[model samples]
Target: MSAIALTRRRGRRHSIRRPRTGFLLVLPAALVAVGLFVVPLVLAARMSVSDWPLLGEPSFTGLENYRAIAGNDLVGQALGFTAKYAAVILVVLLAVALGLAMLVRRPRRGVGLLRTAFFLPAAVGLTSAALLFYELYFAGLSPVDDALTGLGLIDRPIDWLGQPGTAFLSVVIMMTWRFAGFYMLILLAGLQSIPDDVYEAARLDGANRWQTLRHVTLPLLRPSLALCTILIITGALLAFEQFYVLTNGGPDNSTVTLVIVIVREAFSFLDLGSAAAISMVVLGGLIVLNVVQLLALRRER
Candidate 1:
C-alpha cells in the first residue's frame, strides 16, 4: 500500500512539472538580468558610500560623499537646472505631441508619408540628432537666421547658442523636433484603441468633436499619456548628449547638464569619488520619481 501511494505521488509531481516548460524557458533571461543588471546596480549602491578611486581600494567613508555634495553650490545649481530643463521639455513634448496625435489620428491623405517623415528623426541616435541640429542651426540649415532675414524679422543674424537663454531654447527645439513624433506615436496608439461606439454615443448626445475628445477620448488615453510624461521627464533629466554635442555646455555653462558635469568630474578631472557621488544622487532621485509616478498611477487606476 505504501509503495502504491509513493508511485501515485511521483506521477502527480511529474505531471505538474511537465507543462511548466514556458517558465523554464524564461529562467535563463531571469538569471541574466539578475547577474548583469541587478548585481551591478547593487555594486553601485555599495560604491556610493565609499571613497572609491579608479586605481585604489575604496575606503569606507559612510556618507561623506553625500555630505560634501549637499553643501556644494555647483551641485545645487545643476539640480535646479536639471529640474527646470525637465519641466520645460516635458510640457512642450506632451502638449505638442498630443496636438499632433489628435490632428493625425485618423486616416488622411498622405498621412502615412507624414508619419514616416516625423518618426524618422527619432530613429536617429541622440548624439547624431544633436550633431545634426548643431550643424543645422549653426551652418544655416536651421532657417532661424534665414527665416528672420527673409521676412525682415530681424536686423541681424542671431547666433542661437551664443547666449544662455537662446542656447537653452535651441536645445529644447532640437529635443522637440526629434521626440514629439515619438510621443505622438504612443498617444496615437491610445487614440486608435478607443472604440467608435463611445464617439457615436457622444454624438447622439449632441456632443461636438471637442466635446467627444474631452468627455471620451482624453480619459481613455490617460495611461499612455502618463507613460510618455514619465519617459520624457526621465530622459530630459538625464540629458547630456544634446548639450554636449551641440553646445558643449558653452556660452558660460548654460547647457551644462548634471550628467555632463559628472562626466567631467570622473573622466576629465579623474575625480572618481565625486563622480560616483553624483551618480548615486541621480539614481536616488530617479527611484523616488518613479515610485511617485507608480503610486499616482495606482491611485488613478
Candidate 2:
C-alpha cells in the first residue's frame, strides 16, 4: 500500500526471523531443563501428596506427610544440627578460603604452585575425599596416631570419629580441606578483578594494609563473599557423604544432617511421601534464605 507501511511490515518480518535462530539455539537447553528438572519436581510434589511406598500402590494421603514433619523429633534434631554445622563450616570455610586467596593473590614465584596445592583437593570427588579421610581416621597403628602418641598429645590411640564432638569436627575438617581451595579460586578471581587504581588510591590516602583491607578490599569483595557464603551454607546443610561414610549417623545420630534425614526417610525407611515432604521443606527454606540474601545485598547496593 504505502511505502512506510511496506517498510514497517518488512521490519516486523525481519524481527520475527531474527528471534527464530536464537530460539532454536536455546530449545535444546529448555527441553533439558523441563525434562530433567521441571518434570521431576512436579513428580516429587505429586509424590509428596500421595502415600508412595517403595513397592506399593500410591494412594492419596493429603498432607499426612507434612503433618508428620511437624511432630518428627529426628527431623527437628537434624535441622538443628545442620544449622550449627552450616554456621561453623561457613565461618571456617570463609576464613580459610580468604586466607588462601590473599596468599596467592599477589605475584610470587611459587604462587601458582600454592594455588594448585590448595585447589587440588577440590578436584577430587567429595565422596572419594570423605572415604579417604574415613580411612585415615580409622587406620590403626598408623603414623598419625603414632606421632600424636609420641608427642604426648594422647595417652593412646584415639578414635577421631568415635565421639560425637570429634566426629563432627572431623567432618568439618574434611569439608574445609576439600572446599577451601575451590572458594579460594573464586575469591582470587574477585581479587584480581579489583582495579589496581583502587588499591593505589588507598595507599595514597596513607591507609595501611589492615586499614585498606578493612575499608576497601572487604567492601569490594562483598559480592564474592556472599556467593561463597551461600555455597558453603547450602553445601553444609546438604552434607551427606562425609557424615554418611564416616559417621553413618552414629554416636546416637548426633551428626545426622538434613539431607541424611531425607535420604533415611525415602530409601532407608521406604517412605517416599515423607521424604518428598521434607525435601520440599528444605527447598522452600533454601529459596527463602537465598531471596533474603539477595534482597539484603540489593538494599546495601
Candidate 3:
C-alpha cells in the first residue's frame, strides 16, 4: 500500500478506537446491572413458574404457583396489610419529619446536638430498634404504655402486639421513630437550599409565616418531597423486620405483610415456587409504581 493510504487508515483506526474506549468504560456498570439485578429477576420468574421445593428437583408447572397464591386468602390479606402499613407509616413519618425540619432548620442553642439526638435512633440497626420497641410494647416493663397511662391517655396498659388494631399502630410508631430523623435531615437540606432572598422578599411583601412556608418553602422543596416520598413508599412496601420482631403476623394475621408471606412460603413451608412467584409480583409492583411516580413528577417539572 502507498504511504499516504497507510497514514489515512491509521487515522481512521485511531478515531474508531477512541470512541470504542469510551463505550468500553461505560460497559462495566451496564454489565453489572444485567448480571446482578436483571439476571436474578429473570431466574426468579422461571422459578415461579415451576413446582420447585427448597430441597426437591423442580418441575415446570405452568402458572400453578401463581394460581395457588391468587387463591390463598392469607396471602391476599397480607398484601392489603402491607399497603395499609405503608400508607400509615408514610403519612406519619413524612409529616413529623417535615414539621421537625421546619422547626429546627434555623439554628438555635445547641441545635447541632439536638439534631444528633433526634437522629440517634436512625443510627441504631433496624432490627435492634424493632426489638427494643417489642420489649417496650409488651407487658409490665413497657415505657410506652406507662407513659400513655401516666398522661391519662389510657386507664390500663395496652397490649400493643396482642391486639390487631394496636399492633399495626405500634409498628407505625416504631417506624416513624426510626425514620423521621433521617428524613428530617433530608428535608432540612432541601429547606436550606432555598435562597434566603426568597424568604426576605416574602417578608417584605408582608407575608405571614404560614404564607411564606406555603408559597416559598414548599415550592422550592419539590425535589426533596419527591425523594422522601420515594424512600418512604419503597421502605414501607418491603417492611418485614418490625412486624417480624413485634407481631410475627399475629393477632389474627392483621399485621402480615407480603414479605412475611414470602418468607413463610420459602422457609416455613419449603415452597420455593410460591415464594419466587410472590417476589416477582413484588418486584413488578415496585417497578410499575416507581415508573408511574417518575412520570407524574416529570410532568410537574
Candidate 4:
C-alpha cells in the first residue's frame, strides 16, 4: 500500500475502536443510574397505583391514592405553604446572592476572607444549622432576645418559632443564610465572565452606576440568575430537614411543607401508597415548573 493509504487504514481502525472504548468507560455510570434512580422510580410508580401499606401486601387500587389527595386538607395546606415559601426564598436568595456577588466580584484587600466568611454557613449540614438556630431562637437561651430585653425593646422575650408569622420568617432567614454564599459564587462567576470592555463602553456613554448595572450587568448575568432561581425554587419546594429539626411543622402546622406531608403519610400514618402518590405529584409539578423556567429564561437563539 502507498504510505498515505496505510495511514488512512490505521485511522479508520482507531475510529472504529473509539466508540467501544467510550462505551466501556461510561458503563459504570449508566449501571449506577439504572440501579439507583430508574429502579426506585419504577417502584414508586408501582406503589402510587396500589394500596401499599407499610406492613402488608400491595394491592392494585387504580388511582384511588391520587383521588384521595384532592380531598386531603393537609395536602392543600402544605401545598399553599410550600408555594409561599418557594416564592419568598426565591426573591430573597437572588437579591442577597446578587449583592454578595457584586461586593466580592472585584477583588481588593481581605476580599478572599470575606468570600470565605460568607460561604462558611453553606458548609454546615442543614440539620446542624437548624439545630443551632433552634437553640438560638429559644427564649431564655437566645442572645437576641436577651439583647433586645436589655435594650428595653420589648417587655418580654419573643417566641421566634412559637407563632406562625415568626416561624415562617425564621425559616426563610435560615435558608437564605445557608444558601446565599453558594449562589453568590455562581453569580460571581457570571459577573467575571462579562468582559470589562462592556463596562468601559457603558461608562464612555456617560452611564452612571445604576444605569450600567440595569442595562449592562443584569442583561449579561441572565444565565447565572436563571440557574440560581431554579436551584432556589427546587430547594425551597422540597424543603424538609431544617423545618423538621427546627419547628417540626409546629405553631399550628403553619410551616408544614409538601415533603413533610409526604413523610407524614408514609411513616406517621403508615400509608405507603398515599405517600408514593404524593411524591409522584410533587415530581410532576417539579418537572413542569423546571421546564417552564428553562423555557422562559433560555436565551433567544
Candidate 5:
C-alpha cells in the first residue's frame, strides 16, 4: 500500500480498538450497577404490585397497595411532615452553608483550622452523629438544659425532644450541624472558581460588599447553590436516622417521616407489599422533584 493508505488503515484500526477499550473499561461499572441498583429496583417494583408478606410467597395484588395509600392517615401525615421538614432544612442548611463558605473563602490566618472544625461533623457517620445528639438531648444528661437552668432561664429542664415542635426543631438543629460544613465545602469550591477579575471589576464599578455579593457572587454561585438545595431537599425528605434516634417518631408520632412510615409498614407490620408501594411512591416523588429542580436551575447557554 501507499504510505497515505497505510496511515488511513492504521487510523481505522485504532478507532475500532478505541471503542472496544472504552466498552471494556465501562463494562465492570455497568455490571455492578445492574446487580446492585437495577436488580433491587426491579424486585421492589414487583413487590409493590404483589401481596408480599415478610415470610410468605408473594401473590399478585394489582394496585391495591397503592390504592390503600390514599386512605392511609399515617401516609398523609408523613407526607405533610416530610414536606415541612424539607422546606425548613433547605432554608436553614443553605443559609448556614453560604455563610460558612463566605466566611472561610478568603485566605487568612487560622482559616484552615476553621475549615477543619466546620467540616469535622460531616466526617462523622449520620447514625453516629444522631446517636451523639440523642445523648445530648436527653433530659438529665443534657448539658444544654443544665446550662439553661444554671442561668435561671427555666425552673425545670426543657424536654427538647418531648413535644412535636421541640422534636422537629431539635432534628433540624442536628441536621444543620451535621451537613452545614459539607455544603460549605461545596460552596467554597464554587466561590474559589469565581475569577478574581470579576470581583476587581465589580469593585472598580463602586460595588459594595452586599452589592457584589448580590449581583456578582450569587449569579456565579448558582450551580453550587442548586446542588446544595437539591441535596438538602432530598436528604430532608428522606430523613430517618435523626428522628429515629432522637425522637423515635415520638411523643405522638409527630416526627414520623415517609421513610420511617415505610420501615414501620415493612418490618413493624410485616406488610412488605405496602412498604414497597410507599417506597415506589417516594421514588417517584424524588425523581419528579429532581427533574423540576434541574429545570428550574438549568443555566442558560
Candidate 6:
C-alpha cells in the first residue's frame, strides 16, 4: 500500500475502537434496562393474555380480558374521571409552575429564600404528602375544617374529600402543591438558558411585560413547556396515591383513577389478567401521546 493508503487504513482501525469502547461503557446500563424493564414488560405481556390468578395454575385467556375491558362500565367511568382530573391538574400545574418560574427568574433581595420556599414542596414524597393532606382533610374532625369554620369561611365543617367535586378538587390541589415546584425548576432552567441580551433587545423595542412574555419568552420556553406539560399529563394519568389514600375512591367511586382501577382489579379483585390488560392499554396510550408530543416539538424545532 502507498503511504496515504496505509495512514487511512490505520485511521479506520483506530476509529473502530471508539465504538467498541462506547459499547463497553454502555453495556452495564443496557443490561440493567433489559433486566429491570424489558424483562418485566415481556412478563406483563404474557400475563395479560393468561388467566393468572393470585394462587393456582395459569391458563390462556387470550383477548377475553381486553374485550371485558372494552365493555366494562366501571372502567369507562374511571377513564372519564381520570381524563377530567388530568385536564384540571395539568392546567393548574402548568399555570402555577410557569408563574413561579417567571417570579423567580429575576434576582432580587430575598429571591433565594422565595425560591426555596416555592420549591420546597417538590422535596416531599408524594405518598407522604398525600398522607399529610389526608390528616388535614379528615372530614368533620379536620383542623382545616375547624379553622375555616372558626374564620366563618363556612357555616359548618366542610368535607374536603366526602363529595365527588370536593374529592376531585382536593386531589388536584394536592397534586399542584406537590409538583408545581418541580416543574418550576424545569422552566427556571430553561429561562436561565436564554441569553439576557434577547430580553434587553425586547426592552429596547419598548415591549411591555405581557407583550414580551407573549412574543419572546413563550417562544423561547416552548421546549421546556412541552416537557413540563408531557410530564404533568403522564403523572396525572398515573395518579394513584393521593386518591387512593385521601378518598379511597369513595362516596360512590367518584375519584377512581385508571391506575386505581388497575390496582383494584389485580389486588382487590384478584384479576391479574384484567389488570395487566388495562395496564397495557394505559401504556399504549402514554406511548402514543409521548410520540405525538415529541413529533410536534421536532416539527417546531
My TM-score estimates for the predictions, one after another, are 0.85, 0.89, 0.86, 0.91, 0.90, 0.88
Return the candidate ranking by TM-score, descending.
4, 5, 2, 6, 3, 1
TM-score of candidate 3 on Cα atoms, chains taken together = 0.86
Clashing pairs in 4: none
**On lDDT, who's better, 5 or 6?**
5
| Residues 1-301 of candidate 3: C-alpha lDDT, one tens digit per residue | 9999878878885454677788899999999999998998888999999998999799999989988987999888988888888888888988899998987899889889979988999999999999998877775356866798999999988777889988888888888889899999999999999989989999999999999888888889989989999989998899999899999999888888999999999999999999999888898999999999999999998
lDDT of 6 by residue, 65-88 (tens): 899998989899999998998889
**Candidate 5, lDDT over the whole model:** 0.92
Error of 6 at 269 (Å): 0.9
Weakest lDDT window of 10 consecutive positions for candidate 5: 11-20
Candidate 4 structure quality by residue, lDDT tens digits, 1-301: 8999878878886445677788999999999999999999999999999999999888999999999999999999999999999899999999999999999988799999999999999999999888888877774356777788999998787888999999888888888888899999999999999999999999999999999999999999988888888888899899999889888998899999999999999999999999999999999999999888878876452
CA lDDT of each prediction against the hidden true structure? 0.86, 0.92, 0.89, 0.92, 0.92, 0.89
| RMSD value for candidate 1 | 4.5
Q: List residue ranges in candidate 4 displaced over 4 A.
A: 1-22, 139-141, 150-152, 299-301
Model 6 vs. true fold: TM? 0.88
Worst 10-residue lDDT window, candidate 4 = 136-145
The local lDDT score (0 to 100) that residue 84 gets in candidate 2 is 96
TM-score of 1: 0.85
Per residue, candidate 5 scores C-alpha lDDT tens digits across 1-301 of 8999878878885454677788999999999999999999999999999999999889999999999999999999999999999899999999999999999999999999999999999999999998888877884456766788999998788888898898899889899999999999999999999999999999999999999999999999988888888888888889888888989898798999999999999999999999999999999999999988888776452
For model 2, residues 144-255, the per-residue Cα lDDT tens digits are 7889989999888877898999899889989999999999999999999999999999999999999999999998998999999988888887889989998998889999
lDDT of 4 at 193: 98
Predicted structure 2: lDDT: 0.92
